[model samples]
Target: MAESRSKLVIVGIGDDGLAGMTESARRIVAEAEVILGAPAMLSLLDGLSGRKEALEPDMPAALRQVREALASQRAVLVSGGDPLFYGVARYLCDRLGKDQFEVIPHVSSMQLAFARVKESWEDAYLTSLAGRPLEAVVDRIRTAEKVGLFSSDEHPPNRLARALLDRGIDYFRAYVCENLGSPDERVTQAELTDLASMDFDPLNVLILIRKPNRPDQASRAGRHRLFGNPDDMFAQTLPKRGLITQAEVRSIALAQLDIRPDSVVWDIGAGSGSVAIEAAQLAYQGMVYAVEPEPADVALIEANAESFGVPNVRPVPGRAPEVLASLPDPDAIFVGGTGRQVVLVLRSAYARLCPGGRMAVNVVTIDGLATALETLKNLTSEVQVWNISIARGIEQMDRVRFEAINPTFLLAVTKTPDVSD
Candidate 1:
């Protein structure tokens, strides 16, 4: 009769390794027939009497090796810090099934790093850079008051600090914790600018604590109003600056677009592509075609897309109606500046839209609205027009006063299958 396979135990160790482990955890490691871990982890169990196996540098292969070993004898897979908090234990559980192993966790390095910095982590944005793109975690950190990052070999603290600083994100006080709980453990704190020039151990957690009173560090609403973001929030062409769609108008148009994560959209007359960029972010998996006629505006759109890191936006450098031919049909469309060609663009866009697709046209004057409404009446049966007037508060002589922006008209039309014929 074959011997029964022993259960796999995944144990988390602090920077102190076995010395910091609980007695029960130590006993489990000592009794294991096969011990699998990185060299650093293996060094912790130097005198242990077991069939010691060094884990591969590659995580997936190491996990595979661990699973094969689990079929024969009792094994302990050792990892540093909390096994589940951006650690290997979660990956193991996910790949091998939760029932296949028991996980023993220790304090995560993120928690230790935050503790070292004397900051509460309940609200911090936590992520790991290991085997992942830095851009994958940047958006979450962009507005977070606190951020905890498990720095990897490829994307270390210095690189991350530099990336953040380069993107005008200088609101955080960076703290790097190296070898937490070890005798040589060190926690270094500095401004993000200062951190970009420094170096630290490979095994480190990078904590970003937002500096007090920093303008960009404030909460979303505290920093700026919801509807009308500052014109500088977007990238615009130099010579044709301020020609981009107005914030109030874009806000109302976005609302009419009814944007969601799955929305497929088109921004005709994309200008600097503010609406298209924001819409792309809101509609993550969905597509946003930024159709612009001006080459400078198209270049600005590309620059804006890079800064925002929104991959969903496709900047098409050409006039609409003609360019709309090659693109996928949109769920919604926003016409920012159509001039006298407003009716023609709407008619073409309406025909290209899938049934139930929405199209919103922003008109600064009543004449433009009349043209759009007339075109909508001919194209589809239902059209809703809204005149949006926004007043932004300005602080003057210690008194707050409302500054009313130019009112704009938004005409929203929904296409119907029956209207096509």
Candidate 2:
């Protein structure tokens, strides 16, 4: 028979410490023969006697201490705020199994921060900068009406605010709430730019609320239209000006994509981000990733996405195939510029596409079309090809004249479902 494990109580304490804890929670801590928590959190309960084990930030060492303490004595683990809200209690529960422990949660610091700002955080984007890369989150912040951030020692409020400013995001009013529920608690509010240059206490939550009725900071001379906006509406760089997929072709490809409000789409070689921006608007509740290699095109993609007020579009500045690996698998993919790596990109994309996902590739040259059709046909039997030839009526001196644009080929494929199904 297996040895019975001692019951562990994980108690969440606030800055007020013992005073903030409930009578039941205080009793549990008082009866514990061993207690584990951060050194600072342990210091708050100096009045209660127990064998105190300092919980290190290193998770492995902390878990080792937890196991040793629980094996020999009645253990009570102390954490800050709600033990599960980005707290140590989550890790303990996962490692030790939820059935082995009881959790007593206090109010989280994030909750207190939101309260201090008098803002509703139900719809706000909440995240922490402890282990997550800052780059992965900055784009999400660009479109959020409100955001709550738990600042780490390495990525403090000032550094985060500066990072936001550098990305052309300056519409949010910043609030740094420091030392919540403590004697030195302070709340500082300012513009994001101003917040970037200031310092704050190490223990703080940074809240950002967008400026009232503020339009996107990026230029928006072009009118915002749904799918099928004219090609000239986008700000494309010279030399690559004529390379954009014609408006008509884009409209057809989008239809074939069968995009939904929550579909994840990819616009590979997304020059000036025209297609990606439009797709983002279509997938309003979803995400669109624009992958481009040239530095200039990447900048244009970002500018265009912002101008269209589509915060869902993320401009990934890198080549396809390789960069596609990092992104979430797509529900729909549009390949615009292949750089003669059409086969490689198609195969990689087809492999990563979710079941029943759609892929649309446009090619202007016969050789390119042949390769695309052959490649797509290998992925699934449901392949379609369209020859798009569009002309606009231009008023001549005496009559309306039709100006023909170059013909393009669009090939679409839907991934095959499981045969067993």
Candidate 3:
């Protein structure tokens, strides 16, 4: 009798029940002396000789039952759709050693939901609401192109839609897919506002597709502008005027950063967040952290971010080196208004920047410029410095006179592939 193999079989079934399972999976389920599943999953099958156990809510009790059953008889654990995809199979396998069981998967409900809506989910953000906070999930969905959510009674589609709407995220078209793979399956499409007040079946997948070209509509003034817009174009703080970076220097610094569409950037000592805002625009698909210690400056950054409709720029309030510890590592960093601690901040940022990333610093004093240049030279061989002096034309009665703007120095460097190099 080959010593009676004691393998436990885990099969993924669907609303279609036995008809949905493969021949091998069906045979495994039929031969079992004991089976475990949620009440809805167990209700799908009939006329089986196995003793069925309801596995919802009281999972620990069900696991104990499965363990006792496996001691003397063949056991099978049934689940809806792919058992490995946000299902109980992973938990079971983790608790009951991998060698003791065999897993067979079916098409996941997320896959079915996308298929029903005729959309590709190759890059969709997919997650289950069973144990996640609604706010955290909504924040993740803010910039997603497509999202698939496994909703529970506690966090249903309507509740999720209302949360999203409250966050000013109304750019996605909503789809509620119910009873997937069953004869009475339904997929309902509606705008986010409409979906916020509607009801859905307990067994449903929520799909959100971002409206076509809607994400950028808030910021697209005319033609796609990446960086180096006029300095006056940004909202500056009152009374602390003339502190923003000039357009000429901003252009040079931006070119030096060599930002990609998805590059992560940090603008340290962000005064009124002009550089940070422009960097945010250039790195539209990525995130930009504007680290400013002053409360007023932090407020200005947020106001400017809203006015420009750039959602990716986050205004961080705190002193540097300490604050930088909490922020994500950056592909590029821009330091301005470092006061007398220019070298300290520069060294801290340099230590955290990713390899091949760039840093650009603006200085008006000779002492600040010298310190930055010296520290950057020790980090990499690809260091460049430029002295930017601009002159604006003023129309007189008979002629145009050019008045020179104050001179500023910009020091830019690229980190080596490794510290040893």
RMSD to truth, every model: 12.7, 9.3, 11.4
Candidate order (TM-score): 3, 1, 2
- Residue lDDT tens for model 2, 1-421: 9787787788999887888889999998988898899987898898788888888777767777887876755899999888888888766775556777788999999999999989989999988777544654575687789999989888898898888888788889999999889888999999887888899988899999998887664433236678999898888999988789888899999999999866789999998988998898788667899999999999998888767778778899889788987786678999998887889999999887867789999999999999999888887876899988988999999999999999999999988765653
lDDT leader: 2
Q: How many backbone clashes does candidate 1 have?
A: 0
lDDT of 1 by residue, 100-161 (tens): 78889988888888898899999988877774445536656877888888888888888998
User: In model 1, what are the clashing residue pairs, if there are any?
Assistant: none
Model 3 lDDT per residue over 1-421, tens place: 5566587778999899999889999998998888888889999989899989887565456667767766756888899999989898776675556667788998998999999999999999888887454544676688799999999988999999898887688999999999999999999999989998899889999999998887622223344256777777777777877878887888889889988866789999998888888887777656789999989989989998887767778999987877887776688999987766777888999987877789999999888788888888876776789988889999999999998888999998887655232
TM for candidate 1 is 0.54
Candidate 2's error at 405, in angstroms? 35
- Give all candidates' CA lDDT scores: 0.80, 0.85, 0.83
Which has the greatest TM-score? 3
The TM-score that candidate 3 achieves is 0.59
**TM-scores, each model vs. reference:** 0.54, 0.53, 0.59
Task: Provide the clash count, candidate 3.
Answer: 0
Off by over 4 Å in 2: 1-3, 216-421
**Worst-scoring 10-residue span by lDDT in model 3:** 216-225
**lDDT (C-alpha) at residue 420 in model 2:** 50
